[model samples]
Target: MRVVFLGLAVPNMNEYHNMFTELVVEFRNNGHDIMVVAPTYDEKVFGMQVEDGIPTLRVPTLELFGVGKIQKGLATLLLPYQYKRALKKSKIDLNFDLVMMPTPPITLVNVASWLKRKYGSKMYLILRDIFPQNALDLGMMNPKGLAYTYFRKKEKEMYFASDYIGCMSPGNIDYVIRHNPEQNANKLHLLPNWAWLQPNLGQQEIIKIKDQYGLLDKFIVVFGGNIGKPQKMENIVALAKSCTTNKDIFFLIIGGGNEKEYLDRMILREDLSNVRVKDFLSREEFFKVLQIADVGLISLSENFTIPNIPSKSLVYFNARVPILASVDLNTDFGTHLEAIGAGLWAEAGKTKKLKEKLMYLYNNPEKRKKMGENGYQYFKNNLLASMAYENIISRVTNT
Candidate 1:
């Protein structure tokens, strides 16, 4: 099948391991032609190139991220127009069987609709980030305001344009259905976040990473990825603060975002000796460090009405690391983890409960190892790239 994948992220397979690259590679291996129509802000003109044997069309637009909120909003609002104009100028082949896109801006309905019209393609929506509502839940946007109304309309348009909507979790599917009663109920399906599993690190390499980071004898609890508002970093701060009494337990935070400075200040002001903060690591180094991690961490704000299953969890699962999740009650993330026997969880604001869970892990290595193995097996059976590819292809092709 000829497919066009659309999103804000442009995956360079050599630089990092991402789900999109895994899906693209698998599709190509199965004899499918794929074109990645991704946004690029570095160039002023639309350009085309072949990367890793797949055609990538880079469309120039007001850059997303690394900008203020207002500018970011403007860029997101203009993405569809920029992408459409760029694609038209390319004069490339438009015969596509399926067109897949993810939600962030929720402003790509125009481009996806155009592709569907032009090629009679089946448009698939990977509902990774539900918009306007997420903003509303975070109090980032007023639901009754004009901006929210406008984006809500666009969100509906995207939903209507999609033939199939693959939600990140069952909770996500429920949220969409409850809020958007007009949407086709049959279209939504549970599609968990996935990662391409890499080979396990050697014991020597793992030891080297542990030693280099001075974590050789510490029980490492890692919080890795974007330190943004939705993460409700206060919970992480509280967790870190509570662990100060236990010198054997360490909080290793690796990631940068709007909230990094806040975390930095807190760590410094409190003289957090048990915690360490570092900028984002290279993909190779990040994976190596994952080997020494005793537990992987995921955080979500209590304010979020939407159940967000962070894609970061998939990385931990790929590395066979058990999760320590602090998410809202509405989210099924904790429930899923418990069901899989892969991890423990506590509510976002329940620092006491989190401390108890942490102590449990500290007191029990057998439990930790068993949970990590269960997580790895669960990842292989449920969240593998092959599973996602087959599910998507089967649905779209009725195969």
Candidate 2:
């Protein structure tokens, strides 16, 4: 099979590990020809390159990440045009068996539609982020405004263009069905986030990480990933404030985003010494910290109407660390955790309830250990990268 993946970023496969790269690697390993088309901020870096045996075409685009919302919006709106022009200039083959993309910039619908028309390709959408609605939910956009109306149309178009829509959770599937009644239910399938599993870090390596970070004999509760608006990081700050009296319980936040300054301000204002914040770490570094963590924290804004299953949880599950989530009521994340006997959760913005759950994990060592074991078992049984590869391959081939 020849597959072309369109995504926001394609890292150097040898130096980075992410869900997309891992999945593409699986495809490459299984004897599929894969081409990744992604954006690069540096013009000099824009071109085709084979990284770790996968051919990737880096298209030049405006700065997207860590920029103002207006700039980010413009860049997203230009993605389809940029990608199309780049593909033409490169003179690469357009005959793809599968055209795959994960949502963020739903504007890619145009590119996908063009490819499908040109080559009769099957479009697969890895529905990670639901747009426009998520914007409205976060109060980032007015539903009555032009931007919302435009993106809402694009969202539908993207869905229409897709031959199959792979939802992250049952709640996501339900949301899509209820919202887009025109979409065929048969085309929607559950394709959870997946990762290339890594072996657990040894106790000596864990101790070295703990010592290097000045974290010794403390129950580390970690939140690692993008510390942005969707995260509702204030909730994590509130939790940290609540736990300040307990010296043994420490909050370690590792990530960078627009909200990091806000989080830092809150921590300083509250005079909370138990909480520490670190900037984003490499994939290898993150798992080392995760391995030493007692609980992996997940936070979502209470405002979100969409059911977002954070990809961050997969890292926690893979690390054999139990999750303690404060998420919106709409998501099935908490329910999923409970079903797997992997963690506990509370409704977002409920500091008291979140604290109680955290305390429960802190007080019960045996339960925590069991939950960690269960999470690892669940990861092996359900969330392997090979499972996702087979799921998509079987559907695309049979159809």
Local distance difference test, per candidate? Answer: 0.86, 0.91
- Provide TM-scores for the models: 0.97, 0.98
lDDT of 1 by residue, 1-399 (tens): 898887787655545546777787788878998988887666553488777888888887886876777889999888889888878888988888888888776888888999899889899998988898788988889878989999989899999898999998888999999989999989988777777777888789889889999989899999898998899888988998998888889999999998899989988888889988889987667877887999998999998888888888877887888899999998898999999999999999999999899789888999999999999898888888888888888888872
Candidate 1, residue 198: lDDT: 75
Name model 1 segments beyond 4 Å from true. Answer: 44-46
Best by lDDT: 2
* Stretches of model 2 off by over 4 angstroms after superposition: none
Measured on C-alpha atoms, candidate 1 has an lDDT of: 0.86
lDDT of 2 by residue, 1-399 (tens): 999999886687767857888899999999999999999877677789888888898888999989998999999999999999988889888899889999888998899999999999999999999998998999889989999999999999999899998999999999999999998888899999998788899889899988988888899999999988999988998999899889899999999998899989989999989998998988887987899999999999999999999988888988989999999999999999999999999999999999999999999989999999999999988999999999888888887
lDDT of 2: 0.91
